[model samples]
Target: MKYLVREKMFSIGDDFWIEDEHGNKAFYVDGKVLRLRETLVVQDPHGRELAVIHKKVISVRDAMTVERDGEVLVTVRKKLFTPFHDSYRAELASGDELEIRGDIIAKEYDIEYGDERLARISRKWFRLRDTYAIHVDRDDADPAMLIAIAVCVDRLVEHEHEKHEHEREQHER
Candidate 1:
């Protein structure tokens, strides 16, 4: 299944609906405000929360957790030593690791479990430039979980980008 995601989700309290390829609302991103840490809830059209994505402090590196019903489903952490392409690892609660790799800032990447590809996120399918697609290639895969993971990585990348920009501006000051 392929879902279309608009790139207008850059800030806290920004809410948006992600639609399927058929143009029907599939999931909603509810950004909760007035929280000490960033939190986002991925909900179904009927408003049932499926997963929660939020920032995790106290870690050596920045990390985010994807939770379901107060349980940690996956914790997304950046690989500290990537000198080439950007990457993140989704540590599943079931003790499996999903590798996220490729040009992340461009919204082009692949989520794979060792040898199998679970989903691919890219802007190559749409000409809108601001919209990207999440194509889940496996029937056994949980789409919401994958989507939440993507969001997790996105927030991390955006935070990193913001930090870099701040440092650059400070250097020039």
Candidate 2:
């Protein structure tokens, strides 16, 4: 189904995950507003007018839930990022900056019984077991910092695992 917000005519595509108010998960060819773009009017560091935006999109492989405020929430999957559960909070900070292109929009299409149907008609949908995006600012806060921290934590976890594995091997030998 297609829904028009403002003047933009959006068509929901094929792969979408939906979670209702009751906490039940549903998959849609293109889920309804599983993702959205919120535009921010701001001035750059140099005081130039710029359109800062945060496109909150859901992950592909994880289940997601939708709140009454129309916000989509997804869990941190282990495969997407190591030590995925290092922190329980998933909300992006105010100064976080997201990397995305002007044309980077989510899309999906489905084929059923050799007949293609629009699973999502221009609305966003969440993906079961997928990551989500939250755009912030590029000021004092940096998204890369969080990513780096997460990476470091993952490495540490891996290092511990490897050490244990090595000890096990030695014992066996």
In TM-score terms, which candidate is top?
1
In candidate 1, stretches whose alpha carbon ends up further than 4 angstroms from where it belongs are: none
Candidates' TM-scores?
Answer: 0.97, 0.23
Summarize candidate 2's per-residue lDDT along 53-168 as a digit string, tens digits.
Answer: 23224545321121212332211222344342222222223422222111112222121112322122122433432332222122343322322222222223343466789999
TM-score for candidate 2, please give it: 0.23
Model 1 C-alpha lDDT per residue in residues 75-132, reported as the tens digit of each score: 9989878999888999999999999999998888999999899999999998898899
